[model samples]
Structures are given as C-alpha cells and as structure tokens.
Target: MSVKSAAAKLFAKKIYKKTQGWSSNPIASQKNVLNSLIKEAKKTQFGIDHHFDQIKTFEDFAVQVPIRDYEDLKPYVEKVVKGEENILWKGKPLYFAKTSGTTSGAKYIPLTKESMPYHIEAARNAILHYIHETGNADFVDGKMIFLQGSPILEEKHGIKFGRLSGIVAHFVPKYLQKNRMPSWETNCIEDWETKIDAIVEETFEENMTVISGIPSWVQMYFERLQQKGEKTVGEIFKNFNLFIYGGVNYEPYRAKFENLIGRKVDSIELFPASEGFFAYQDSQKEKGMLLLLNAGIFYEFVKSDDFFSDKPRRYTIGEVELGVNYVLIISTNAGLWGYNIGDTVQFTSLKPYRIIVSGRIKHYISAFGEHVIGKEVECALQEAMEGTNARVNEFTVAPQISPLSGLPYHEWFIEFENEPDDQAIFKEALDNAMRKQNMYYDDLIVGNILQKVVITKVVKNGFQDYMKSIGKLGGQNKIPRLSNDRNIVEVLNIK
Candidate 1:
C-alpha cells in the first residue's frame, strides 16, 4: 500500500471507533443533539418566537415549534437572505443551498457555521465506516469522481448560494483533492451535457477507482464513458470497486448498471439532503444506512398515514418503531425547526438505528388507496429483474384512472437497457413481485377494481428527453418514482 492508503486506513479506524460511541447510544445522542440545538438557537429570533428558551424537553420543543416547510418559513428566510443577523440561527448563515421548488418558487436552505461541518464529517465517516468494516482503504489512493452540480456560487447580500453538492465542493479536503477527478474547469461547465462530455474526455483515461453520484446521473456518465472508450466501465477502470450514491434507490438501476459496467460493485447508499446529512451505509452487510443520531440534527417522525391528519403525533428517536413508514420531520442546528423535509423512511434495523429512504411523503400513489411507495416499486422491479436479461434503464409509475377501454390500472413507463426475450413472463414476474410487496395493490387487483400493471416501453433516452424539455435535465433533479396523478404519464404519450 502507498503511504496515503496506509494513512487512510489509520484515519478510518479512528473515525469508526468514534462513530461507534454515538451509534451504540443513538437515543442519548439524539436527545443531546436536540438540547444543544435548542440551547444554541434560543437567542435567535426564530427561537424567541417559538419560546425555545423555555423548552425543557422534546415535547416542549415540538409544542413550541410547529412543522414548517420552505414556503412556511420563507418570511424568516427572506430576512436571512437580506443579510439579517440571528433571525434563524446564531449570527449569519455561511451559505444558502438553493434547491428547485414548485410554483411557490426556489427554496434557500441555510447552512449555519455550527451545522456545516457535520455535512463534511458525515460524508467522511461514511467512507471510514465502509473502510473499517471491509478493510478496503486502498481505493483512496486511486482516482475518485463525484458527478455533481457546478461548484460555482452566486452571491446575494454577502451569503453564497448554490446547490448543496456545489457548496460541498468547496470543502473537499486537501488530502483527497489529488485523487478527485474531473478538474476544476470541467466541473465549472454549467450545462450538464457539456460538462459530462468534458468529464468523459478528462477522466475516461484515468485510473478511476471510486465513483459517486445519483445512479441515474452516474448511468449517464457510464454511457458516455462507454461511448468514448468503447469498453464497459469496469474494463476501462479495472480498480473501480466502490460506488457511493444518494438521492434515489439503486435497486431498479442495479441490473442496468451491472450491464454497463460488466460487473458488480459494492455500493454505499447515503441519505444526505440539502436539509441535513441524515444517514449513510456503514456496513456492506446491512440492509439500510446507519442513521446519524449525533449529526447535530433532531429528528421527529409522524406516521405517514396520519401525516395530514389534524395535529399528527411527532415521535422522537426513542419512540420510532421498526418497519413502520413515518414522515421524517427534523429540527436542526441549521435553524430549521419542526421542518418537514417531506421524506418518509422506514427503520430496517432498530438495534443501532438503520433506515431506508422509504419514499417522499408527497411522491406516492394512493389514487386507488393502495398507497404504493418508492421502496415497494423499486424492490418489485429489482426482484423481477434479478438473474434475468430484463435490464431496465429507467422507469416511473403513475395511476391510470381513465382509459379508453377496460378498468384503469397503474401504468409503468420503462426505458429498457435490454429487452426481455419473453415480455409476458417479465411482466408476470414484475406483477407478482408487486403483489407480494404491497397487499393493498394486490387487494385492488383481487377485487377486480384495477387491472394488471401495463408496461409502456419508452423510446430510448425518452426520460432524458422529457427532463431536458422541462429544463430539469440534470444536477439534483430526480423523477418521482410514484406519482398519484397522470401528469407524468400524460406527457409520456402512453395513451
């Protein structure tokens, strides 16, 4: 091993030990985080408004601060944007992570000085945890690439604003800078297509060993690399072994990715968000990412079924149960209190608190009261595609409430990497998987209320074309795995 590799293993061992201290005592760590957040923010305007000074427990904090989204907290965010001090957290925020919003407009999530380090630390610890667990730290000496948003930032009233991934680029540690790929110039290219082309030219010849990005975006990168090099990504980068990802489930893309790479790679699933760095895969053997209880964020969960109910009960870390879907709410040192990040997560393991991103609370299909989530669909697709040449490039599900003939059913728009020899068998396998995963969907089918799932093969790169048409082609933009309405399907021209 190189000096760097030896040093990385040592560092990983140390960090892994530190993380174990908190991971073993998750509930206590969470309570301490909540107390620290409240104590530090008490002097701020938001804290004063919410009576944070008098907050003695999680119950008091929840009662004092109501759940708020970006729009709901826009008034305070506006003040922060206009260079106001101590409006949300202590003093001024270091940066504003500008994320795409709906009709309400763009959202500016604050990254306070006290909270920003946790993002970097969480990402670092994720890798360290992997290295310590697997005893594989040699990849640190090879080229690593992170396909992400442009690191360029725009200034508004003294605060730098940009995509969370972009903002994080500024903090890439000096030690790993040498191993990082796609030079500063390539990363600065604003157009994702152009940047990707440039990245292909820059790094396709390099010794890339670790690659990180959303699976969809990374798939695009792999396609480009294959086009350029005329070889599977695995062949081109023989040492490549680790794939770290977030933003979307990789299960549906697993078959396609393996085909593109021509091999299987160990992957780490991360649960990072603009709101906060929540969790990361700590063990290759585990089913879910280890929730970061000591990440300077206080978490709350409202059972997703009752998320819209009148005053839903907010359960803290200690109260959360295993296997239940709950809408994740957070109060962070970043100055977001009772903030509904809109994600629903299920605890896969409670002994040390590991969770899988179940789905976005808003991004589900309950059109027929089946309430199928992202995890279910992804899991179903994964099971169907396993050990088969049924390679799926991309797919999304939407309710087909109206049809020209027969009962309405769920429409699946799929872009196939490899067309199955027997479409009927593939579809049957997919349907069976879905039926087994979700009882509600199975009941609806059994009741003859809905027909079997209809598969509409999308034109090659059709989803990419659609996203480009809508100006959300790349970066952090993601297609909702499940849509309650036919807005996406209608545009998909499936009729």
Candidate 2:
C-alpha cells in the first residue's frame, strides 16, 4: 500500500474516533453543534465583540438578518477594505478569497481565521465520508491529485495576501503533499509563477492516484496530458482511482473523462463555493450530498416559493422536510448572519440530511420569457438524450439576442460522445420536451413569437478548453448551464 493511503487510513480512524457517537441523526444533532460553534466564535479574537446577539433560534436568524444576496453584504465588505473592525470579519482579515463574479469584475471576499477552519473542516469531513461510504479506503492505495487553484501570494496595492486556496494547500498533510499536481498561475491574483511551475515540475510522472477539482479544469488537464503525448488519463496517472469534482455540475462532462481515460474512475461531487464547502457526495450509490451544518455556521432553509413573502418561514436542519426545494441561508462566523448564497437545493432524504442542488436562484434562462432553472434544464437534457444512441458529453444553454431581430431565443452548445446523423432531430426533441414542461416555452413555440431554438455541435472538450484558456478551471470556477443574456454567452466565443 502507498504510504499516503496508510496515513489516510490512520487519519480516518482518528476522525471516526473523534466524531464517535456525534449523532447518527443528522438533523436531531445540529442544535448542539450550532451551540458549540456559537460559543467558539465568541471566544475567537474576531468573533468576541460580535458574538451573535440576535441569533437565538435558527428562525430568529432568518428574521434578524433577512435573506440576503451578495449585494447586501457589499457595503460591509467595502468597510472591511477600509480597515474597519467588526464589519465583514473580525481580527486582521487573513486574506480575501478571489472569486469569479458574474456582474462585478471579480470579488475579493475577506476571510478570517475564525471562519477559515470551517472550510478546512468541511473538506476533512468530506474526505471521511467518502471513505466511510465507499469502503474503497480499505483496498485502494494510490497518490491523490488535487486539481486546485493557484497557491501563490498576491500583493494588491501594498496589501500582501495569498489566495485562500493557496493557504489551504499549504496546510495539507505533509506526507501526501507530494501528490498535488502543478497548475499554471499566470493570471492568479498572485504572481508566484516561478514557484508554482517549480511545484509542478517536481511532481511530474509521480504516482498520482486520485484527482479532484472542477470537471472543466480536469478536462483541460487531461487535454494537456494529451498534448504531452499521453494517450489516456490512465496512462498519465497509472495509479489513479478517485475523481472528485465541484463548483459546477459534472454530469455533462462525465462521459468525456471516462472515454478519454478508457476506464471508470470513482467520482464524488462537492458543493463548494468561495464562501465555504457546503455539501459532499461521499456515498458510492451517487445519492444526495451530506451538508456541513456545524462548521462555524448555522444553516436555515426557506421554501423557495416563500422567499418574497412578507413573513418567510425558515426551517432548521432538524425541521427541514424531505423532497422540498429550499433556498439555503447561513449565519457564519465571518459576520454573514443569515446570508443567502443564491443556490436552491432540494432534500432527497432526512436520515443523513441528503440534498440535491436544484439550481441557482440567479442562474436561469428566461430568453423566451420562460423561467427555466438548472433542474428543469437538466431534466430537459436528460429527456432529450434518452433513447438516443448518442450521449450528450457536455452542453451549455443560453439565450441568443440580436438587435436586428428584436427578440431573444434559446441556443444550446452540445458536445456528444459520438457524432449523430440527425442533429436537427435531437434539437427538435429537446425543444419540444422543454416546451412541454415549461408553459412559457410552450407559448413561445406555439405562437412563433421568439426565434426558433437552435443547437450547435462543438468538438469534444471545446468549452472545457475555452474555460482553461481563460485560466478558470477548478472547484470555484463557474460554468453556467443556463443564461438568458448575451454577456455570459460571449465568454464561449473561443474556438
């Protein structure tokens, strides 16, 4: 067995022992967890003065800090930038998590030591859960590759800081440290190009056993491997066993990786963002992800339909019902009290509190005046692909608007496992399916009010390569499945 695997096993045992009897009932046990965190935050240098005064109950938090989007916290973040104390985070803010922004240029999210551990703990829990569910931990012995963001330090106008990704990478277990693969850091908010290149050069041809990151970035890495004359992913990393993906959906890109590698790799999904790691798919059955409810935060769920109501009722972890779609609101040590991260999720089960990412509240395609979410798009794509010999390897849906035409219409960029003869038929079926499910789509199609829906076939890995070219290829990287505007669509203009 590889030394890394042995160490991981040892750590796993320790983790199990530490969390032993810590509640098999996920919901019933969260109150105790939240209480402990609230106490800890009060003790932290940053959280002392701001020890949650109004957050008594989970519902109390919802009422205290009304469900807020990122914009709601912008003013506070600006205060942090001005060196204000007790605004965004307490203590000297360690650094900002430079994140991808849709409307803004790029977000510099401040992080504090009080809340940094939440991200680390969430990751640790994810690792533990993966081992517990798969039991592959017993047999598998290989190096793990983290297809992560840059680990470089940045100095913006004399303020010195490194990326939060860099900080996390720095603290990984010393033994398995050799397993991290090198990635380019050209535009990395940090200018550690030389050091980053050195790290990658040292690990070339090493025994990389598991790979994890954004599906798109991982695809880019595989393409880079191909350019280096490596015929298959397995050939490049002969010891690989696990592939973990996060930030965006992996369903569309799954087949391409399997085909290129010529073997099936165990896959896991992580629901992580610049804010924190929230969900993890550790189970082998590919069920819903388990959440990190107690990692320096208190979580509340509000029914998505009830969001704009005068009195929106929120549910605690224990009170949440199964099969209901809810918008997640969080109160974290980072001074975000009942902050809404914009993603919508549905509870699949109650035992371990398993939930599926339904879609983003902001991410929708209403081009034809039909509001369609991520889940709806996923359903439409699945229905269209059913019974078809050709499997959809990857896809992006957007609304194309032309000033001359004066109306916008649906457009899809589809990548198939194998080219199909009847491309028109596939597009027709998908459009028909979407219209049947969404009344807005049905009206547009029946009245011929908007431009006809169109699908364009791209070479395999086309979009993946496009994202990589822009240096966005990892867990925090975003690939929108639905867009009603042309601004985001233009990002895909690359060949």
Candidate 3:
C-alpha cells in the first residue's frame, strides 16, 4: 500500500471505534444535539420569538415551533441575506447555499460556522467506514473526480454564495488536492456541457479511482468518455472502482451504468442537503444510510400519510418505528426550525438508525389513488429489468387521466441506450411489476380504471434537451421519478 493509503486505514480504524460509541446510543446523541441547538440559538431573534428559552424537552420544543417550509421561513432568511446577524442562526451565516425552485425563486440556506464542518466530516467518515469494513484504502492514492458545479462564488450581503456542491469545493482537504481531477480552471467553467467536455479531456487518461456526482450528470460524463475513447469507462480508467452518489435512487440507472463501466462497483449513498448532512452509507452489507444523530441537528418525523393533516404528530429518535414512511423535519444549528425539506424516509434498521429515502413528499403520483412513490417505482422497474436485456438511460412517469382513447393510463417517458429485444413484452413486465409492488395500482388495473403503462420512447438526448431548454442541464439536478401531473412528460416528449 502507498504511505497515504496506510495512513488512511489507520485513521479509519481510530474513527470506526468512535463511530460505534455514539451510533450505539442514538437517542442520547439526538437529545444532546437538540439541547445544544436550542441553548445556542436561544438568544437569536427567532429563538426569542419562538420561546426557545422555555423549551426543555422534545415535547416542549414541538409545541413551541410548528412545521414550516421555505416559504414560511423566508422572512428570517431575508434578514440574513441583508447582512443581519443573529437573525436565524446565532450569527451571520458564513455562506448561502443558493438553490432553485422555491415559491420564491432561489433559496439561500444558511451554512453557519458551527454547522459546516459536519458536512465535510460526514463525507470523510463515509469513506473511512468503507475502509474499516473492507480493509481497502488504496482509492485514496488514485485520482478522484467530483463532477460538480463551478467552484466560483458570488458575493451577497457580507456572505459568499453559490451552489452547495460548489461551496463544498473550497473545503476539499489539502492532502487530496493533487489526486483530485479535472483541474480548477476546468471546474470553474460556468456551463455544464462545456465543463464536462473539459473534464473528459483532462481525466480520460488519468488514473481515476473514485468518481462522485449525481448519477444522471455522471452518466453524461461516462457517455462522453465512451465517445472519446471508443471503450467502456472501466477500460479508460482501470483504477476506477468506487462510485459515490446522491440526489436520486441508483437502481433504475444501475444496469445502464454497469454497461457503461463494463463492471460492477461498490457505491456509497449519501443523504445530504443544503440544510445539513443527514446520513451516509456506513456499511456495504446494510440496506440504508446511517442517520446522523449527533451532527448538530435534531430530527422529527411525521408519517407521510398524515403529513398534510390538520395536526400531524412529530416523533423524535426514540419515538420512531421501523418501516414507517415519514416526512422528515429538522431543526438545525444553522437556525432552521421545524423545517420540512420535503424528503420522506423509511427506517431500514433501528439499531443504529439506518434510513432509505422513500421519495420527495411533493414528487409522487396519487392521480388515481394509486399513490406510487419514487422508491417503489425504482424497485419495480429494477425487478422487471431482471431476466431481460432492457436497459434504461433515464425515465419518468406521469398520469394520463384524459387520454385520447380508451382508459386513462400512466405514461412512462424513457430514453434508452439499448432498446429491449421485445418492446411490447417489456411494457407488460413494467406494468406487472408496478402492480405487484402497489396494491392500489393493482386495484386500478383490475377495476379497469386505468390501462397498463404506456411507454413513450424519448429520442436520444431528449431528456437532456428538455433540461437544456429549461437551463438546468446538469449539476445536482434530476427529473422527478414520478409526477402527479403531466407537466414533465408533456414537455419531455416534445424534446
């Protein structure tokens, strides 16, 4: 092993013991995090207004604050944007993770001095745990590529601001700087297409071992690499073995990725957002990412089914149950309280609190009461792809309630790198799998209320074209897996 790899393994061993200590007592860790957050923010304007001084227990905290999405909390955020200190967080934010698609155009989530280190630490621990579990740390010695937005930042009211991924680029450890790929000048390229092209040119012959990004954007990178070298990505970068990703489920894209790389690679799933780094895959054997309990954030869960009800009960770490889909709410050191980031998660392991992201609460289909979620759709599609040569590049489903003919149906817009040998049979398999996974969908099929799914084969680069039309071609953006409306499919087919 290289000296760096040996050092990495030793550090991993030290941290693995520390991880086990707190992970073993999750409730206590959560309680301590909640107390610290409340105590630190108590003197802030928001803390005073919400009576944080009187909050002593989870119950007291819950009663003092109510669930609020970005729109509801924008007033305080505006204060911070105008150079105000101790408005939402304890002091002015170090940076704003600017993101698109709020009721108001762009959201500026605070990244406080107290909360930022945990994001970097969570990412580090994920790799460390991988080393501890597998006894492999050689990837640290090879080139690592992180396909992300430009590392450039824009100045705001006394704060630096940019995309979350971009902001994180500034914090990459000095030890890894030489191994990080796609030179800084290339990373600073503003346009994603141009950036990827530059990246392909820079790293195609380099000894890349780890590549991290959202799957869709990384898929574009792989396609470009394939076109340039006329070979599988694995052939081009023989050392590449670890694939790290977030933002969307990888099951639907797994087969396609395997085909592109010419082999299977171990992957780590991360649950990170502008608000906080919530979880990371700590074990290759486990099914879900480990929930972060002591990361300067307190979590709350309201059952997804009851989320929109007049009064949905919030459950803390000790109060949660396994296998229940819950809309995740968080109160963090950055001063977001009773905040709903719109993600829904299901507990897979309660011992150390592992969770699988179920879907986004807003990004699902219940058009005919079928109520299909992102995870179910991804699983069903993966199930159907078994024993078939069918491969998907990307896909999205939308309800076709007022079709031109016969019964209403679900329309699937797919861009395929390789068409199935039997298209009609593949469509049937897709519908059958959907039915098997969801009883509501089965009822809709049997009752003749909805026809089997209709497949609309999107043209090559069709999804890319649609995204380009909207100016969101890459960088942590993805098409929703399922939509209740035809807004996506209507434009997707046009592209």
Q: Using Cα atoms with residue i matched to residue i, what is each candidate's TM-score against the true structure?
A: 0.76, 0.67, 0.76
Inter-residue clash pairs, candidate 3: none
lDDT of 1 by residue, 1-495 (tens): 888778888999999888889989988899899889888988999989989889998888878998887778889989999999999999999999986442244678999888899999988889998888888978988899998778999999899999898999999999889989789988888766778889899887898999998775687789889998899999999999999998766776689789999999999888888899999999999899888898888899999999988899999888999999999999888888889887889999988899998877777776554557687788889998987898988899997765788867888899899988898988989999888877657756764657899999988888888888899999999888879777786776331
Q: Count clashing residue pairs per candidate.
A: 0, 1, 0
What is the descending lDDT order?
3, 1, 2
Which regions of candidate 3 deviate over 4 angstroms? 364-495
Taken over the whole model, the C-alpha lDDT of each candidate is 0.86, 0.64, 0.87
Model 1 misplacement above 4 A: 364-495
Q: In angstroms, give how far residue 349 of model 1 lies from its true place.
A: 0.8
lDDT of 2 by residue, 372-460 (tens): 65656777788878877768777778866443454446877777786556777877778887765665466455534455567777676
- Model 1 TM-score relative to the real fold: 0.76
101 Cα displacement, candidate 3 (Å): 3.0
- Whichever of 1 and 3 has more lDDT, that candidate is 3
| Whole-structure CA lDDT of model 1 | 0.86
